[model samples]
Target: MDTSAIEALPWCADLSLNSANIWTVQQGRCAIGVVLLVEKSASVALIRKARVEGYEFSDRLALPGGLVRGVCGPSFAPCFEQSIRARAEEEAGLTAEQLSELAIAAPEFAPVSRYTVKCVERFAAVFTVRANIKRPQKLISADKSIQEAFFSPLPPKWEELAPANRLILARAMRDHAGDNVKTAARASVNEALAFCNDAAATVNVPPVPDPWMSPEA
Candidate 1:
């Protein structure tokens, strides 16, 4: 991963990952989330999501994250950092300070814009933790948002994860290849490659033209 590239990114405050910033047809929206990768020994942590009443995909497995609301003055890097840290603590009982001790992956974004769908841009950061120095039991018990949480091998149990999480996890792992957690970095390469291959066959397409304002249109 290019640590320099991450460090040099131009922070944009307008970008967000808050669901509350729902975009209307006349405008676009931006939001952010984080993938909390907690590692110990050779295993990584995963939360078996609890079923939120009347919530869509509430039971789907996902990393610890939430909406990125509010601005962080001139730079949004602090917002991004704080958002993930807060979410990790809220949803998984992991502290931002603890996460800072681990390997952090470069931020990644996936923008989706289809005429038939909502136009929104979502950004995510990966906060990896090598918890050998921390008390795993205390951290685990403090997480109140999950139904069940457990540690699994690196590269994860692909079949056991939600489809979206599989890709997110793989991508974060790939970008964090140089993190302190060498096992996750090394194991994630193959998984990320495989996902990319499958994705290329389906999602690789030419850029969509702006139908509303185009010389050709």
Candidate 2:
């Protein structure tokens, strides 16, 4: 599969809900896309001091993505596998296709955790991509929430990323060093599937029915 195709997998984002000021365990699944675009002339595609309203990490440098919904929703509707690429195109103004024909360069997976008012869990996935794109441009912040986006060389303080995301990026870097896309993809798919399976198992809430009434009453 192409790099974009691989990145477009239906990765789920976890959200948390609460009741009575106590954190209740509830999960809300939302599809998200993350892009890894590398250009020879660019140092990195990392944006600094970006802003997204209602979120505290406004100035943090991170990958560009947004919540995916039906086309009628705020963001464009993306197919199951193309969601990542679609969001990349929409948010960062970048277009990506499968790089199968090109030499399999580098591939990696990163785990990102979600701890909002909706859910709490360590979400894991491999972040893989080809490293030979021509003249990749700075990501355009189509959404007003983002203040800026650009490329930069991987930072020395890479370990500072959210623990889950850091893990995936570290793995991707190692796989890239070894030029092991196949292995990385396999491992990522397994992990992603396991997460989905576990999440599905928790959604077993049965419907509540009205109280029964006795004819004697």
Candidate 3:
């Protein structure tokens, strides 16, 4: 189907689609994971998307993210930063306008938040961005792939979360507890990436690039 986002990824050099409609990433792929937190909450009330039924990890609580494909431009545009920016908007309704810092969704911007996830066929580089939102429940979406979005309290019951989410979130809350939103978000995400190592292992991490690369691109 749409291959623009996959093409923009330098690492997906060996990407193909010979097996019907399924993509083949020989080297690996990039899965964009966003850690959406709300501002001034009593506790770590993290926002999680409830995946829609009939797909992998359906009905499970998870960070809003997906593969790099179809993110930058569902029709034509593509790029690294746009992919992340697009995912943040599409999944969490947090637009680049809302958080100007989110506009810089580039590689190497925060290497600490980057890591790899293993799969049977290949692996995925998990690219993450952490930000705080205002009243997450108000931003919940129903038209997207997810059934809905809601605030899942921090220290969420590990059993209720997606495996990768469990690993990442648990490690984040445990090792990076603090008050500063950005600092805490950074610590938790970076630390979790370092500790869990392969949170998306065995799970199909979707490629979530922006529908459009950018106004300039």
Against the true structure, whose lDDT is highest?
A: 1
Q: How does model 2 score by TM-score?
A: 0.47
| lDDT (Cα, tens digit) per residue for candidate 1, span 1-217 | 1223333434322333343542111112222334566667656667766766644335666666554444454344565456556666766667645554543443323211111113332322222322223655444524555776666767576555543355555554543444454444344434443443343223331121211122344
Could you estimate the TM-score for every candidate?
0.54, 0.47, 0.50
Model 2 regions more than 4 Å off = 1-33, 37-42, 52-56, 67-78, 96-110, 117-132, 156-163, 175-217
- Candidate structures ordered by lDDT, highest first: 1, 3, 2
Q: For model 1, where is the 10-residue window of minimal lDDT?
A: 205-214
Clashes of each: 5, 21, 10
Q: What ranges in model 3 sit over 4 Å off?
A: 1-26, 29-54, 70-78, 100-123, 134-137, 176-217
Worst 10 residues of 3 by lDDT: 108-117
- Candidate 2: Cα lDDT at 99: 19
Angstrom error of the Cα, residue 6, model 3: value is 17
1 or 3: which has the higher TM-score? 1
Cα deviation in Å at residue 67, candidate 3?
A: 1.1
Model 2: per-residue lDDT, tens digit, 42-65? Answer: 244544435445443455555544
- Model 1 has an lDDT value of 0.45
